[model samples]
Target: MESGFGTRRRTRLFDDLLALFLAEGFSQFTLDDIAAALHCSKSTLYTLAASKDDLVRRVTVHFFKRATAAVETTLSRNDDPRERVAAYLTAVGAELAVASEVFMADLNAFPPAREVYEANTAAAATRVRQLIEEGVDAGAFRAVNASFAGDLIATMMVRIQQRDVGKATGLSDAEAYTELATLLTNGLRT
Candidate 1:
């Protein structure tokens, strides 16, 4: 039973769904669970996606799309190359600030969402590489292998998303990200 909602309304619903998924994760929430949380009926959710997996994928796509846009928007606000690089990293960390352990665990456990996440990381790594180049041009970063450094940052981002990082280091995901940003920025400073 599809609801003939306006495009704005539908986008609003996706926003709510994305927020919930970020806070709680994908695997544990059934359609009924989401309906209850979102205060909407299952049929209304049907208007967004046909099935639970479809809904998860749709919401995950929405999440990543909005995240990339926001990161770009934020990065563009700074003119300084080093500031832009820092803003880029901080924006990525901001995306995960709401993600709890359960949310991350479920995201990694779900194959489709995990792939979306991995792709997002790869894209972010590309941005990091570009930022490193910009920083080098501006004489803010040493002109080493920026591509290699970006790869290292990407790998570190993946490891930070893992549960064991928090478990072993006694830092939350947000904390781990802040630490990573500090270490990377400090190491690259010229």
Candidate 2:
């Protein structure tokens, strides 16, 4: 097993790399850039990560782990499926709103990162479908095609968040959640 100091050092390096990646698109930066940004040498980075691709994978995994935790926290706050769905979307929107432009640009630049994002999208869609199914079973939502509707709504919400539509509409994250919840609930209501 790695020593505690080694683990801390690795964590710090990863955090620094993540911050840099979020600030500068992955493709825009070279190994030298990362090394210079972190005040370290290229050899040190090589020692820490096998290659740039490995670094990207590590960063993507780190991001997803943190995001998944946030989603779980939001889900835990409510027992009602409808409320859980709203909370989840709101959390997602907040995340997108705060995401750096560089991060979005970098995501587009990296094909592997894009693939990872797609996988996450599918997973999120499954979660949304489950919530919708639960709501339907509880008579909290209408009798509709839960899977299809869930995917559609999830996609739309992602687009809206990415576009920062809430800012244009002069709505806070909470307001956006309420509006989205209203829309979904109405569409699914008996």
Tens-place lDDT per residue, model 1, 37-125, is 99999999999999998898888888889988988998888888767777888887787777767777887777878788888878888
The residue-by-residue lDDT of candidate 2 on 99-190, one tens digit each, is 46667656755777766766765677688788889888988877878878887877755554343654478664435656776677667766
Relative to the true structure, candidate 1 reaches a TM of 0.88
TM-score for each model: 0.88, 0.79
Off by over 4 Å in 1: 1-5
- The true-versus-predicted C-alpha distance at residue 152 of model 1, in Å, is 1.1
Best prediction by TM-score = 1
TM-score, structure 2 vs. true:
0.79
- The prediction achieving the highest lDDT against the true structure is 1
